[model samples]
Target: MSEVEKRYLAAKERYAKIGVDTDEALKKLQEVKISMHCWQGDDVKGFLNPDGELTGGIMATGNYPGAAHTPEQLRSDLEKAFAMIPGKHKVNLHAIYVDTDEKVDLNTIEPKHFSKWVDWAKEQGLGLDFNPTFFSHPMFKDNYTLASPDKEVRDFWIEHGKRSRKIAEYFGKELGQTCINNFWMPDGMKDNPIDRLSPRKRLMEALDEIFEEKLDENYTQEAVESKLFGLGAEAYTVGSHEFYMGYGLTRDKLICLDAGHFHPTEFISNKLSSLALFSKGVMLHVSRPVRWDSDHVVLMDDELTEIGRELVRNDLLPITNIGLDFFDATINRIAAWVVGTRNTQKALLKAFLEPTDDLKKIELENDFTTRMVLTEELKDFPFGDIWNQFCELNGVPVGLDWLKEVREYEKNVLLNR
Candidate 1:
């Protein structure tokens, strides 16, 4: 047997001793598709304005060489990233990334603007997800759109939101998978606003107007994301957690929980179970936040593992949509994709390999000692072996082998750009 097969066999036997079937874990994990956000490839500089400055308190730091400057380049970079990641996954898109020659603003964007992406997705056998670019445009005047008191500003955004759903529906119909069109607005105040309720109310009314037309749930799922604070909007945010939580519950919409959007002390992992109880479904924007909402590349950190554990242990996977949302222009963009995506997959695999039933049984029986012991022991398990085996199974380069190819590509493809 090969080294990978041999290691996997040994690891499988070890896990089986704890009543964990590594094979079953791997099988389940293979089917879980993580939506790889495309903005990371181009530093959130969508095709709409490749050279424009980021508004909405959004920033993609670093002058990383070879940032995608066009749709074809972005697609090529995505393809390169996908090759390194095991298991088929979806590509997440922002409306600003629309690939078309026609002159169309956000208010007029249609599904045809993204037909090229749909065609490429079909060719790659991948699914598609979408987000409306509510920030960085002139219409987003005074750090507001939907919540803006000006009816014209609100009307412009409402139309964009409407068209975004149509495009998402088209993606679902063409790709044969539900497209999660998430909405996140950078509508807030730099200083503490005296009247937060009014803006929130306006946002609610605008959202209601946008969702008035019901589309088939099979084709599209809408999610609203909440942010704590942003660069300019450090004092107050209209779409606070409470606001989106109540809105999502009342409207039966998917609530997107972005890891970096919360305070450092707050954990989205702990909120998943609660949301599963009330909301129709949940969407995860898995990211890494250092001190502030700095969108660092994801790592196989403790919190990440806990998020994975919560999903698996509570059986929330079926009701949750997973997606990555971080941009680090400091390093190689393609490597950023591979690292973040692979780490996320690894987190899920670790959770899947846990003897969840046994742990729960012990805990329920008041056998705290055993539960703690097993959980700690799992930290030392042959997880790397299983990860390597997974990579081999999926025909992707194993371990650091993929890094070599990334470097070669940087030298050949990235440097030229």
Candidate 2:
């Protein structure tokens, strides 16, 4: 047997002794589909933009030389990145990335605009998730939509939301899988306003009108994502977590919890149980936030592992939808996706390899000292070997060998771009 196979055999036997089946862990990890965000490849600069500049509180900082210039390039780069990842995955798309020949305004977007994407996704054996872009358009210059004072502007946005749901349904029908349609808005104030209540009421009414036309639930699932704050709206966000949590429960929609959307001290791991109890399922936009809501690439941090553990232990994988949401233009764009995705996979693998059943039993028995020691000892297990074996089984490059592949892709394809 190969060195990796030999190492995995040793690790498997060791884990089995502790009542943790490494073979079953690897199998479970394979079933997880981390939804990759397409915006990372193009730095949030979609094709519809007149010029590739971000506005309306959306920002991707870095002048990376090899950013994908077109939808074709973005797909090519994503394919390279996906090839390096060792599991089934999906892609989340913003409406602005729709490929079309005509200038399709926000309210009039049809399934045809994204037909090519559906085709590409089918070819890759991938499902799709969607987001309606609510910022950076002339219609949102006043920094409000679905909560705007002007009836005309509010109605226009309502139409967009309704149409977006239709398109999402179409994607689901075409792909033969359920598609999650996420709705997030940048409607808030830079400074405190006198009439916060009025705007929120209007926002609720607008959302009511938007969801009035219910589509087929089997094809598409709807979710509302709430943000803590934005650049121009630091003082208040109309779609606060409280608002969306209640809204999600009442409306029977999934609540999307972004890691960076909460305060620095808040972790999504703790919030998952509360949401899973009420909402049908929770959607996750996993991003690394250093100090604020800056969309940094994900890493194998403590919180990521805990988040994975929370999902695995709670049996929430079937209900929870995990997706990446970050853009870093400073590094090679494809490499960013590869590294972030691999880290995320590694974290999940660690969670699965854990003796959570026994740990919980210890906690139940009030054996705190023993549980603590066991938890710390688990940190030094042969997790790397299991990960390597997983990559090998999935027919992907094992260990740092994938890093060499990414570097070669950058030099040959990205450098030329």
Candidate 3:
């Protein structure tokens, strides 16, 4: 047997001793899902590089006009591109606006065309996801936090949500797909901090409206069975602003934690477990951090690998969706997707395979003592070995030599001390 197979066997034995079946464990490990946000002009060939190396294309952000064609033509092109992405990767269609103003609009495509697009996506064997941004419309310049002190800006934000909610409702009703409303507010402090809490409240209120309107109310004929139900919104927000909105509104809305969005000061694994504890489904956007910026780079950093693994092992929640949020102009978007997807899978596999029921138990306890124990126990774990094992499991042909090169590059840039 190969060295990796031998190590996996030993690890399997250790897990079996702890009463965990390795085959079942491996199946759980494989269940992790990875997805990406689709841009306006995604070049399929560019994303899936001919060379084995997971590097292709560049990252550019901003309003690019849809290809000069009818909605039907664009839909056709997108269908073809969707088919090219490997079956394993999930594609998130970016903002579909309603009006010419790029800021806030529902999908501009006609209702029939919109339904056709969703049907096409289903036909292509792909899942759908979305990130709601304020920049799509001209009016949302100040931002989407509805209670902004500036009356005009606040109104604009509210109006934006009202319209966006309608669009989300259409999709929910027609497509039978739940919109993962990823709300990332660009309205942070400038010089003096802004009292923008009210805007956020208004946004949530708007979402509650959408949820109420879209859900179905059931009435039973048997004597007395009356029920009113509303379509639910998967309200995913970042940890940075967790304090602004308490658990009440957020509790109902699914809380998704982005590994890169947390400040360096926060404990990510604990935060993830906390979200899981709420019994709200967990969605992850995995990326390496670079100081304050959400680098969206694939999982090459060792510290993040360790934290990500702990989240998986402790929570007992399957990674419902994994997304790569990287932006580099040179790398093909699809190639970036591949690297990010595989790297995340690697990190997850390593965590899934860790041989310690004690560690899992401690995480479940969610107390200070267990936290301290995990902090100390995982301090000296070999992160790179996990990365290597993941590569082995996935049949990644890249060898240790490439990793060594990356290490050397990191040493030159980050070490120097």
Candidate 4:
């Protein structure tokens, strides 16, 4: 047998002794598809206006050459990233990524503009998710959208939100998978506002107006995202966690919990179970935040492992939509995509390999000593062997072997750009 098979067989036997099935874990992990963000390929500079400066507290550091400049380039880069990433996955697109030659602003974008994306997705056997471009626009003046004091501004964004849902619906209908349309805008103030209620109320009303037309849930699901603060708007954000949580629960919408949008001490993993109680579903934006909302590439750190464990142990995978949300232009963008996505999959695999039933049984029986020992001991198990086997099974390069491929692509393709 091959080295991967031998290692996998030995690891399987070890896991079986603890009431865990390596095969079953791998099978389940295969079914979990993460929606990889497209912004990373081009540093959030979508095709709508490539020259437009990033605003609303958004920034991508580094002068990494060869960022995709057109729809074709972005899609090609995505194809390269997907080839290295194990398992089938979806591509997350912002409305700003619309592919068209026509002069159409965000206010007038339609599904036809994204037809190329739909065709590409069909050919690649991938799904598509979407988000409205509520930032880095001329309309985002004074750091407000959907909550702006100007009716013209709010109406324009509301129209964009409406069109975004239609585009998401089109994706789901064409690809045969539900598309999550998440709405997040940098709408807040730099200093303390005496009255936060007015803007929030306006935002609530504007969102209600946007959702006035109901779409098929089978084709599309809408999610509202919140942020603690932004660069220009640090004192108060209109869509606070509580605001969206309450709005989502009342309006029957999926709440998007971004990992980097919370406080330093706050963990999205801790919030999933609680929200699952009342909300029908949730959308996750997995990212790493150095301090504040720095939007660093995701690491296989404690928080990520905890997030994976919560999803696996509590059976929240069925009700959760997973997507990555980070833009790091410092390194090879394709490598960033591969590393972040594979780490996420690895975290999930690690969770699936856990003997959760046994641990829970021990905990329920008040066997804290055994529970603690087993949990810690499982950490030292042969997880890397299992991961390598998974990569081998999925027909992707195993371990650091994928990095070599990425570097080769960089040398041949990226350098030329």
Clash number for each model: 0, 0, 24, 0
lDDT of 2 by residue, 167-210 (tens): 89999999988899999999999998898898889999999989
Which digits, one per residue and each the tens of the lDDT, describe model 3 over residues 1-417?
776666656655655564545566456655554556554323211211111221111124432223212334434434433333323445554344212222323323233424544665567655555544443344434323443446676555545444444444455555454545454444433233344355456545544543444432111000000001101111222123353224323535445555655555554566655556663455555655555433455755675576656666665455344565555434433344445655666666556655556665766787768667655654444444444444455455334344444344334532332
Model 2, position 410, has a per-residue lDDT of 85
Q: Write the per-residue lDDT of candidate 1 for residues 40-144, one digit (tens) a residue.
A: 998898988777789998998899799999999999999999999999999999999989999889999999999999999999999999999999899989999
User: lDDT, candidate 4, residue 234?
Assistant: 97
How close to the true structure is residue 306 of candidate 3, measured as C-alpha lDDT?
65
Model 1 weakest lDDT span, ten residues long: 48-57
Q: What is the TM-score of each candidate against the true structure?
A: 0.99, 0.98, 0.62, 0.99
Please give the TM-score that candidate 3 achieves against the real structure.
0.62
For residues 119-234, what per-residue lDDT tens digits would candidate 4 score against the true structure? 99999999999999999899997999899999999999999999999999999999999999999988999999999999999999999999999999999999999999988989
Candidate 1 scores a C-alpha RMSD against the true structure in Å of: 0.7
- In candidate 1, residue 366 scores what lDDT? 100
List RMSD in Å for every model shown. 0.7, 1.1, 11.2, 0.6
What's the residue-level lDDT of 223 in candidate 1? 98
Candidate 1 local accuracy as lDDT?
A: 0.94
Q: Per-model C-alpha lDDT, please?
A: 0.94, 0.89, 0.45, 0.94
Q: How accurate is candidate 3 locally (lDDT)?
A: 0.45
